[model samples]
Target: MTEYSRKQEALDYHAKPKPGKLAISVTKPFTTYGELSLAYTPGVAEPVKAIRDDPEDAYRYTSKGNLVAVISNGTAVLGLGDTGALASKPVMEGKAVLFKKFADVNVFDIEVDADDPADFIDTVERIAPTFGGINLEDIAAPHCFEIEAALIERLDIPVFHDDQHGTAIIVAAGLINALELQGKTLADARIVCMGAGAAGVASMKLLLEMGAQLDNVFMCDRRGVIHADRDDLSEHKAQFATKTDLRSVDDAIAQADVFIGLSGPDTVSKEQIATMPARPIVFALSNPTPEISPEDARSVRDDLIMATGRSDYPNQINNVLGFPYIFRGALDVRARRINMAMCVAAARAMGELARQPVPNSVLEAHEQREMAFGPDYIVPSPFDPRLIDYIPPAVARAAVDTGVARTEYPSHYPQPVVETDRD
Candidate 1:
């Protein structure tokens, strides 16, 4: 279909049947006056008194344990840049849809119009008690870093910035499998990362935690390479700065084993891909268009394993593969925080899941006869049923092991599947 046609289709999809992508649904019966009284009124005072006596009773009587707030300020709405909070509702709603669809987690998409970081943080903090967790989305960097750190420090429930760690988790998982396929180890791999923004910095950090050497990773922003000698680097970017003579994306990728592009379209040339060592791993993850198209990169070097942020391509490094399941696990254990240990465990779980045999259901959904653990299938599909069973357990185990969990792993967990036939 043409771009215009696709745009109209999207508009129609959201506009039809009540002019939005989501709606509130009643979870309990209200057919009788007795049910109405129980739902809201004199009967509700019982739970109110119980929760008032013990604040922890809120989890038992209310939906707070399963509710996640997908909050955003519209500063960084996907690849669209700062489109304002009102304009970002569609994306936030989409995130809510994913959370509900993937992990059976309930979500309320909140768009805060405040520009000041302090105001945004305060607003979220005031509403923190209502949610089991917070999924911060579309907030720009620098401020995003500060906001997340402050909230994580203050809030008892998990507060995760999906733009940062969600992307990092999926990218790290895919890279693990890709590097293994290329017979390369993270410790020895020479990695060049384009775009030293939220996703780039976070991905590099997670990779380092997973055993990638700092000296071997080079980070580049728009000006050029992020080096130790640079005077204008942000603290987050400075953490990954290398004391090296390489000053450009071209220079940085030369002889490198991995090239991760979170930058704009066509920023990487075929010559740069050619300069990389044999069997390189390239994740040109810029959305809508990548730093280098898979076809363009493949024309230059057929030995490379390629991934992008687009679904049409194989090995798409989508964040849906991370955030929902991660939050599910966090909520299941009543985790105090989604710590580094839990994040690493989620990544490792994702990596291992990709290597297992593909179920017939998943193969049929993708219209494929086979999908072995190889260059094209480095990450599990979002629709993979096993993810619901696999990721949360690993993450919950990590949370318990790390002492971040408030309660023991429940025996009747993973919950019952309420809706099984989802495409």
Candidate 2:
């Protein structure tokens, strides 16, 4: 059976009842009236008074330290893009479960209906008191960019748009590992990015920060290659526009060492893949589809290192590789913000994880579970179980070092247990 069909079947059978995916149960008994008073009423006032006197101690007194809000307007629901808020609940809740399962962070999947960027920002800001951090999910590009910026500016807490930075970080990790395997360097390679949207634009920026030459990088959209001469370019695209004669996606692919396709399915031809430089790296990362099929790309260039966004692929460059651990670290540090250093560090961690000798479990996951790690295996298996232990500490340290953290977080071990609100 196809991997997707198998996965869907599992989901179908598993989701056969009400509250089938998640459950909430009391951890401590509240059977007595005195216990209820301590958990919910008069006795809870002790921690409240302490937190009021020293606000930073809230992380010590309540669940705020480990809770993240996976807030979305449902405007950009994966590849089904702009499906609206109500329709996006499943994906958001799924993200919450991943957050819980991966890092032990409590996630509240909040679906908001305010499509206006300003309204969404205002709503989130007003409700910001509730969450330790805000994870902006599946919002569309351009506007998503603006909303995240506004929220970060307005709130002291970390405000991250997972669609933009999470995908970028994971894709960057793949690129790092892929380039290493190809015996090439980011500084010397020419990159062609198809789809000048959220993930693509952020990926280009992050790559440039990692020493990719701006002039050698070409970013294109539906119209064509985004260049200084392009009449139609948003400020977002304008920043990365190049001064090049290559005005078409076809031209951009020609002579390029890397082709990153965040654009939708079947957009790139096999002929285009054949034209790329020797041993080219192609990340045709489209959801449920790709710009070019891996078989087709490999059919054209045997030396190519190919990846996609699907789990069926050997190297699935999914953001599922980044976000869970990222938030884990941020929350651990009581971070005020997630800055560039944290992202770069996370990417470096992921890239390093890819290069290690594939563990027996990973090899077994492939053989028993139909997944493996190799040339195409440029990342840990999504279910590898080490991401929580590895990636988060790296990011938390980066946040502390960059001075974006409010409470100093521990390294080498988790922080000591503290009394919760119910204590």
Candidate 3:
């Protein structure tokens, strides 16, 4: 589609049929005056009183068990920088759509206008009672890191920054499969990451936690490689800073086994990609336009396995594959937090799922009759029905095993038929 047509279609999509992508619906009977009494006045008061007796009862009587808040300050929208909170509502609403459609999780898209991280944290904590979990969206780095940490400490519910950990989880999943295909492992690979922002920092951290050696990973930002010699590094960047002589992204990519780009468009040249050794794994995750286009990257070496954030390409490292299912498991078990165990479990599950035979539904969705766990098919498709049954149980089991769960393992996890008030 042409750029103008695409813009018009997007605008019309949000403007027509409804003013936005979401609406509130009553999930219980309310047509009759008798039902109204139960929904609002005397009968509602019974559940309210029960909740007052024990705060845990709120999940029993309310939508809090399956409801998530998609919160954003809009400082760093994907492909669009600092669009502001109000401008970010459409994106958050889009996130809500994904949450509901993919995992059947109800969502409230909240756009906070607070500039201060503490203020944003306070606002979220005050409204924390309404949600089973919080999915922070599009907030810029450093602050995104701070807000997530603060809220995770203060709130009992699961809090996740999708741009950070969600992206990272999916990256880990694809990378695991990619490594298997390339005969490489995270522990020994020379990995060059061309970004020091939220996704870059979080991806590196998760990989480190998953057994990637700190010295084997090289991180670069606008000023070049994050090194111990750089005095201007933030704490997050400092965590990856090394004493290497490699000063640029290009320098880091040479002889590296993996090149992961969470940076800007075309930041790494074809010449730079050509410098990598045989059987390199490349994830050019910069959206809309990658650091190096697959065509250009592939032209350099036939042994390269590539992934991108765009769905147009094969092996897309999509957050949609991670967040919904992760939260589904968390909500099912009433988990207090989405910890490292849960994330690693989800990643491992996703990696393993791709190796299984592709379901017909997944093949049909992608206009394919068959797909194997190879270079292009390293991660499970977002539309794969097995995702509902596969990843969430792994996450829920991990949550239970790690002692973060408030409830026992649910016996009724299915592609469930949710009870709605529709008559």
**RMSD of each candidate relative to the true structure:** 4.2, 5.7, 5.2
Ten consecutive residues with minimal summed lDDT in candidate 2?
Answer: 414-423
User: On TM-score, who's better, 2 or 3?
Assistant: 3
Q: Model 1 over residues 1-423: C-alpha lDDT tens digits?
A: 999999999999999877877788998998999999999998999999999999989889999999999999999998899999999999999999999999999999999998899999999999999999999999998899999999999999999999999999999989988988998888889899999888998999999999899999999898788889999988999898888988877788886899999988888999889988899999999999999999999999989999999999999899999999999999988998999988888898888888889999889989999888898999998879999887888888888889999888767665322221111
Of 1 and 3, the candidate ahead on lDDT is 1
- The TM-scores, one per candidate, come to 0.96, 0.93, 0.96
- Candidate 2, residue 169: CA error in Å? 0.7
Clashes of 3: 0
Candidate 2 clashing pairs, residues 3+ apart or interchain: 366-371
Candidate 2 TM-score, C-alpha based: 0.93
Give me the candidate number with maximum lDDT. Answer: 1
Q: In model 1, which range of ten residues has the least summed lDDT?
A: 414-423
Candidate 1 matches the true fold with a TM-score of 0.96
Error of 1 at 16 (Å): 0.9
